[model samples]
Target chain A: MGARERIWTAALIVIGDEILSGRTQDRNIAQIASWLNVQGIRLREVRVVADDSDAIGEAVNALRARNDYLFTTGGIGPTHDDITVDAIAMALGVGVEVHPAARAMLAGYYETRGGLTEARLRMARVPAGADLIENRMSGAPGIRLGNIFIMAGVPHITAGMLEALTGTLEGGAPLLSAQIGCWVAESEIADLLSEAERSHDGCQIGSYPFFREGRVGANFVVRSTSQAGLDACMADLKAALEKAGWPTIAGGI
Target chain B: MGARERIWTAALIVIGDEILSGRTQDRNIAQIASWLNVQGIRLREVRVVADDSDAIGEAVNALRARNDYLFTTGGIGPTHDDITVDAIAMALGVGVEVHPAARAMLAGYYETRGGLTEARLRMARVPAGADLIENRMSGAPGIRLGNIFIMAGVPHITAGMLEALTGTLEGGAPLLSAQIGCWVAESEIADLLSEAERSHDGCQIGSYPFFREGRVGANFVVRSTSQAGLDACMADLKAALEKAGWPTIAGGI
Candidate 1:
């Protein structure tokens, strides 16, 4: 691959109104980001769209156009709003048909539960030409077609499937960063800050501010995949701050 | 109010590397959004920038320009990463000086803890021409100037101070809302959905998809401040879905 060879990436479509309405907590984004970081794969953009079929289809089409992979969660259940399969099928210009394997998995789970009705069979509907992504937690499998993986929205299952899939992906080398956090304002080191930035050619240094313990201050973070790049940049930034008479009162995390 | 009567809104700047590095879970955005909603104010945008002061200043300026108010969290501690005051001061083209109230609050908290070293006193430096927002959890007080209110990033303190200040300020009663969450897929009822939408007046409905209990589905949420408007909207949407053969399933949580 040449220097310009792009790495693999995926966009997350969090299909739930719970997050927008502030009812349910979202654990998927952070979990995915962490998993992707370790695998060196990047979870680029995440959009939490409403459970409207049009909305879902629009998002799916948009993401599929821009990214290497797409993962959608929510809207695949037995109920009315479980229209993900249908939506994706429509978005991809395909038909909705039960994948024999997916139906078998759902049958196994529902049959053991002692009742499988027409409603239960609704869970088995899969878009045509899609392969099943095994679900280790529960039996009903996730569907994958043309780089789009439609999985369960439940955090446990989402994390489980993502973990199962991460090993196969090839992305950029994981970003390594070391940072020291302290209570200081940003402007105190504004001038030398730019010089320090110019000094660190290959590394990126960041400053952040927060309001906590009833005061306002910032944290300075120097990040690089390379350790030596980080160390040199930090040294310059710290020295600049020290000479400015706003030496930090704390260190580390 | 004229069309130009712009509503006051805010965006939060989470300035810790813990968030960017996936070390900490953010509790600020939702908490603040919920608070603002009740106050009839809107929180329109949120950005998570690393603990770099330059990034902090940049985001702050952008958000402040679009919104009538802005609130920031984290980075006000007595440690080095606490650079929010400096960031805001610089963005405002002002200087950083120890506001008497902040110094007094720091002294009060430190006196209770132990010594009031220079490190502890660093918490006292607030932006010039800003008023103090009292932090009851710890003695460090946040500062406010113009429409920007800087508060602690810690959830507990942030909530406390937010509750305290909002209590004293008078607010307009913006439209309140109710939500509906049930299992259904979007594609199952795409056409009648738009017809139902056209029938509504001042209400808006949002849908979301989720996978739960090994099934994927969508969660439909219809919201409106007007009771009559919401009732009419819900009626049309439900009638349309049922006619389309995707009725809301019973016994769903």
Candidate 2:
């Protein structure tokens, strides 16, 4: 929400009981983070919550408050423990019932099996003021309430929902990064770092410590809003390093 | 704090400005989760906070309240933005100064190289009532204030600290796992799942939906206190599936 950057963002709230009990090693956070990172919409934070209604509601409310978008994975299944729908409804201060669109989706899936009962229909429940998030994999569609998008815990369903919401996202310009390694600690190029950071206000400076070829060093990464700013910072950084008696690779000893 | 079984406890807090800015994808959560799951200690809740003093302090206080042991990765660096140490000290209501152990670790890291200054010594500043966590590669030691073990953000250093802490870790009997694939959508197995869950009160039941062999199926996993209990539950599950006329497979099948 700053400048021209729309700051398209999503925080992942994993509401599966399986995660808390140490039953499943979550794969969704990383996969989704990796996917959304490429799309420029940043996946900021991830909270793994149990099936507890209070915990789910609290996390959903909190994350949605902070980010531009909040995506919750898990706890929307048809089983008894899947209480995410109820929690999301409560969080938004809205009542939940079976919407026509959601009911239609579930009916399509459950029509073949003889047992399409009330218990199964519970999966169709959506908050009163919400839009249905498309579900291509399975029938139980996810619901979007304000900034929060609640999806199924299942990997396939989660992935499908991610695809459906892809077109709707708007993100900031993706910052470009360049890393150059040297046999010097972060402290060695303090002035260079300062100049790099100050001269290019829109850039991020990261110094990664490393050891290679029997020498300790750091790879100073300069990232910026514009390629020109990055080049200026890099030039200034190289000059400062060479002036400090740290031999530049191009400038002969 | 639990049963007679040795308890493997771990707490994770993500400490980074980039995470708050949504600049980087978080890999630590999944890595630590998979690591802790195999070792049998639960990696409980994860808190992601910006490099802000108040946010870090509040999260640190809250996490320290619920977990037996806490591990933080990030902000243990020498930079103006590296405010983790100060925030942690503020959280624990302790003062930080150049800790003798940390100073000793940084000794001989850089002598003739006009680097390591008073500002760099800032990394050596540690909480008042804490011990030094070993940093095998870089000399920047992690701080341990009571149950909390603060580590570096770099993956290698974090891995090293985690490894060093493992020898001292109190663990529950290692959790063993067995998995079977069934061709069922998560919604389809709702009722039978409840019965399965109810029947295995002593074990943890995890159902993961996936596409396997071109068929969308749920991988049903049941873990219990003993191998015998696990076997019994699996038998009951197969029987229940067959009786219900679901696509049942033999134990080996």
Fnat for every candidate: 0.06, 0.27
| Stretches of candidate 1 exceeding 4 Å from the true structure | A1-21, A40-253, B1-7, B168-172, B242-252
Model 2 CA lDDT for position A176: 60
Which pairs of residues clash in candidate 2, taking residues 3 or more apart in a chain or in different chains? Answer: A74-A153, B6-B171, B6-B172
- Provide the overall lDDT of each model, using Cα atoms, as 2-decimal numbers: 0.69, 0.72
Q: How far is candidate 1 from the true structure (C-alpha RMSD, Å)?
A: 8.3
Score candidate 2 by TM-score against the native.
Answer: 0.81
Every prediction's TM-score for the first chain?
0.86, 0.75
Against the true two-chain complex, what DockQ does each candidate achieve?
0.10, 0.34
**What's the lDDT for residue A203 in model 2?**
72
Sum up the clashes in candidate 2. 3
lDDT of 1 at A231: 87
**Deviation of model 2 at B93, angstroms:** 3.5
Docking quality class, candidate 2: acceptable
